[model samples]
Target: MAGNQEPLSPRARLAVTAGRAAAAVSRAAGRGSGSVIGGKVALRLDPDLLAQLANHLDVVLVSATNGKTTTTRLIAEALRANGGVVSNALGANMPAGITSALAGGSDARYGVIEVDEKYLDTVARDVTPKAIALLNLSRDQLDRAAETRMLAERWREALSGTKAVVIANADDPLVVWAASSAPNVVWVAAGQEWKDDAWSCPACGGVMQRPGDDWFCGECGFRRPVPSWALSGDEVLDPHGSAWPIKLQLPGRANKANATTSAAVAAAFGVPPQTALERMHSVTAVAGRYDVVGYRGREVRLLLAKNPAGWLETFSLIDAPPAPVILSVNARSADGTDTSWLWDVDYSRLAGHPICVIGDRKLDLAVRLEVAGVDFQVCESAAEAVTACPPGRIEAIANYTAFQDLRRVVGN
Candidate 1:
């Protein structure tokens, strides 16, 4: 209440107050994990609450099928140089979360909000963010988001004729197609690890061939755009051919890619590359995505992979065949009720590997592992699975709800 950043009109103030009260009650009653319920109540009380508060803030919007939460946290941390900032780092990325973020006060000059892929068009219209980052788009929540291509088209239409600066990943063909028509844009080859989704060219709908970092469409002549920043092997290279070393505690090339794009956006807002990277290095985790937790007197490292793309990228970071990690999954609303997407993932990669299968969908995972000829055990509890695993830094990979369940049980 003290850090009310945006001076409000009487009507907006009433809505913010109502929303804050709802959030407090939810937290007190242990019914809601965040301000989502409160945000919804506020929106209903005042339909234009988002636009009313956003009018006074210079904002940056981050959209991605994956990594939106982590990338948003990175940008917000780097912008600490600018003073106070408000962001939805807790995974409340829909309209409700965005509204709740703005409703909470702060004179913070810049607001970095994570906009869900499905709601990018809706939130962008209200915030009119000064800068927007379109990270990679891949199939996720097919039940809710429809298709990846449809989401990209919506993004293109939403930003049409807008004055905001757009930063896009040139490595993802769909991302390139989505951001192509923006009035102003900066492209970054932020190192996409998943290639199966981008094999088909978005332009001609023809098969694409990747000879190296660039993909070419033989039919339509659409090729990878030359990027202003290139993320290669632990370093991001600028247009001047100078390499900025990437040093991070979070393992994986995907994180390096996240850092690369965040630094690029920070520079667009006048923050130096070195300074941005420095701030980002301090980020150890984002809402438990890659967090280490102490559970039952042992360390449990959590990794979340919602869909095929995320699973593919995460697997590339750590050895699977020999590492002996626990795999948890559940068919909850958070992780689309449909478990059909599991087939799209390459489970054969785990053939001959040892793994522990848990979560509500343990039967499904065990069956899949059976087909792949992988050696695995079935467990009902994450605690029991950890005990069965070999000692020292046991890894636990899960879908959305299973990951949250771990967070709650592990006391995060």
Candidate 2:
């Protein structure tokens, strides 16, 4: 067990063993990582297995529409400086997978959990985390995950009177509203690139006014809180007016924002900003995300972008024009059924690039690209897409399942 914590009940112990066995079986059967299935089996046998496994460790729950996995990984690495830390580094973020991760890391001193947006409250209530990182929330899986405001309201209701220290994104109005009720909060000015979902105030349901980077609700007094930590250009400014350059192996401003929030969360756990940032710099990729692999004799960089906000951030991370871009999308269960959010992305930015579209939802993407006045060719597979482009370095952006498919094809 972790530290000097009490031992789990015999039933919980049995549940953990069963979960691990099930996970092994799943892996042997050529299934996925089996974290979720293992978790489900454990929960079925002992519904309170998660609480038992998490009781001994200092837990940090990270939730966001984007960067949850990367931020969780970064926080875990930073916390490792203090002692042993465990996390769902594979991005299996639901309750089942989270439970599996905790059960597997029962001996670790710290638990850094990447939680699904919808399951944050449920997981937090069970785990009783020491710190919670609320990154920016945007429109994601609208058909399944509900609207952003509703999710924020749930977070607000769940976080009210909580004992955990909330490290929230101050620049994101939705995140501000969600973490405002928490007793202790460390606010970070993590920039929000996709403002399409946050136009209305979550507090007053009034139109939000944004002049420059600041935002306030005119109808209500709710506004962007003064952040203790702010990201200015390429550097992150701490509360004491000291600036630290964010030189992470990860790319884009979204990742920089995630790193900033991770540093704050780590600081809450008694780690210094310098140490946390230094540990985070070694993380080159999250799961298969941001991995550059060879395909059809070309170096292809893989980027995952599920929703509009994710797509917007991914676009900034890709190589510039003349490098060619491969856009892939899928309407799998993991990726919400409705592909309407495709229209929300600004694909016009890739106008100059030799764009190739592939995946289950490539036709829908092609239609959207046509409306955006961007030229694109439909492809059957990632291999086909890569071969079509000129041999050199190329960028491949994909949604959930499509990214997995591309990884399989690229053998990453």
Best by TM-score: 2
Q: Candidate 1 overall Cα lDDT vs. reference? A: 0.83
What would you estimate as the lDDT of candidate 2?
Answer: 0.90
**Model 2 regions lying over 4 Å from their true place:** none
lDDT of 2 by residue, 279-337 (tens): 99899988989898887789989899999999998888766688899999999999998
TM-score of each: 0.95, 0.98
In model 1, state the lDDT of residue 324. Answer: 67
**What tens digits encode model 1's per-residue C-alpha lDDT throughout 288-337?**
87788876666778899989889887777666555668889898888988
For residue 377, give model 2's deviation from the true position in Å: 0.8
Judging by lDDT against the true structure, name the best candidate: 2
lDDT of each: 0.83, 0.90
Worst 10 residues of 2 by lDDT: 1-10
